[model samples]
Structure formats: C-alpha cells, structure tokens
Target: MKVSTHTCPVCGFDQLKEAPRSKSGSASFEICPACGFQFGVSDDDDGLTYDEWREDWITRGMEWSSRGIKTPRGWKPEALLKSVLKKKK
Candidate 1:
C-alpha cells in the first residue's frame, strides 16, 4: 500500500502529527508542528485556500473568544484582532 503524507495547508509544513482519536471513533485531525494549525473536517472540505484559511481562522477564533472561550497564549479576542490588524497595516 502506498503511504500518503499530510501537510499543513496554512504553513505548508510537511511535519504533521495525528491527534488523539475521539471516543466515538469519528474523524481524526492532523496537527502541524511548525505552525500549530489543526486540520479538521471543515478544513478538509471547506475549499479554502491558505489566505482564506488565515482570514477565516482569525475571524472564527475571535468569535469563539468573544463567547468567553479562553484563547491560546492568554490572548483576548479584542487583543488578537488588534494584533492581526496591526500586522496587516
């Protein structure tokens, strides 16, 4: 059987690791070590390019954070939005 390699769509990193399987034996996700991007079901079938992923990721992240979900690195939604906007400027 031929082995298939997975790459991070966001950072183009080939070093991807599989995440732990869910209890329900559902779909699995791959995590990119280089950029810490987790590729899930939506990402696989969303037909989003890297640029679109970046934009959508940030937007969804902010939306989740706004709902009181703790974001990575202790960043608030507003703070993360500011940082991204600053980089675009």
Candidate 2:
C-alpha cells in the first residue's frame, strides 16, 4: 500500500517515470531530467541536501539542467515549485 511518488523532490518536476529514491529511501542513481540531480551522487557523495541544491538552482535562474534534453514547452519552474509546496502543506 506504499504509493510511490515519482515527483522530483528538488524542483517539483513530476514527470519522473521512477522515483529518485526507493520506498525504503535508497537513492536510485537516476539523474533527474529536469534539475539534473543525480540522486546518489549529488546527495551521498556531494553531500547536498535537497534544500541546498534547490536554493542554488533558484539562484542559477532555475534553468533546465539536463543536457541534450529539450526544455518542455511552456514549462514554468515557479509554478512547479508553487504547486509542489501547496501539496506539501
């Protein structure tokens, strides 16, 4: 009965086919196509918490971080963040 949430915890990009982490909270090592956050590498090795990366991403203008992946048409990072925050509360 554990529902897997595929939503990216960093920028609220919800199209992730598989969650970055498993149900037991293990990193999948899959890189997010939106924020380019490689789950285990960025977190375990680089020692970045989600909040820290999120702040840096915002400061960097929230640009689509994935290389060679086209930004989705009409994608709005601000709106994505808003929607995700609303769900969190």
Q: How high is the CA lDDT of each candidate model?
A: 0.45, 0.84
- In terms of lDDT, which candidate is strongest? 2
Q: Which runs in model 1 stand beyond 4 Å of their true positions? A: 1-4, 17-27, 41-49, 52-89
Candidate 2: worst-modelled 10 consecutive residues by lDDT: 2-11
**Candidate 1, poorest ten consecutive residues by summed lDDT:** 62-71
Best by TM-score: 2
What's the distance in Å from true for residue 65, model 2?
Answer: 0.7
Expressed as tens digits, the lDDT of each residue in 1-89 for candidate 1 is 95555544454443334432345645356544433444554455565444675566555552331223233454344543454445555
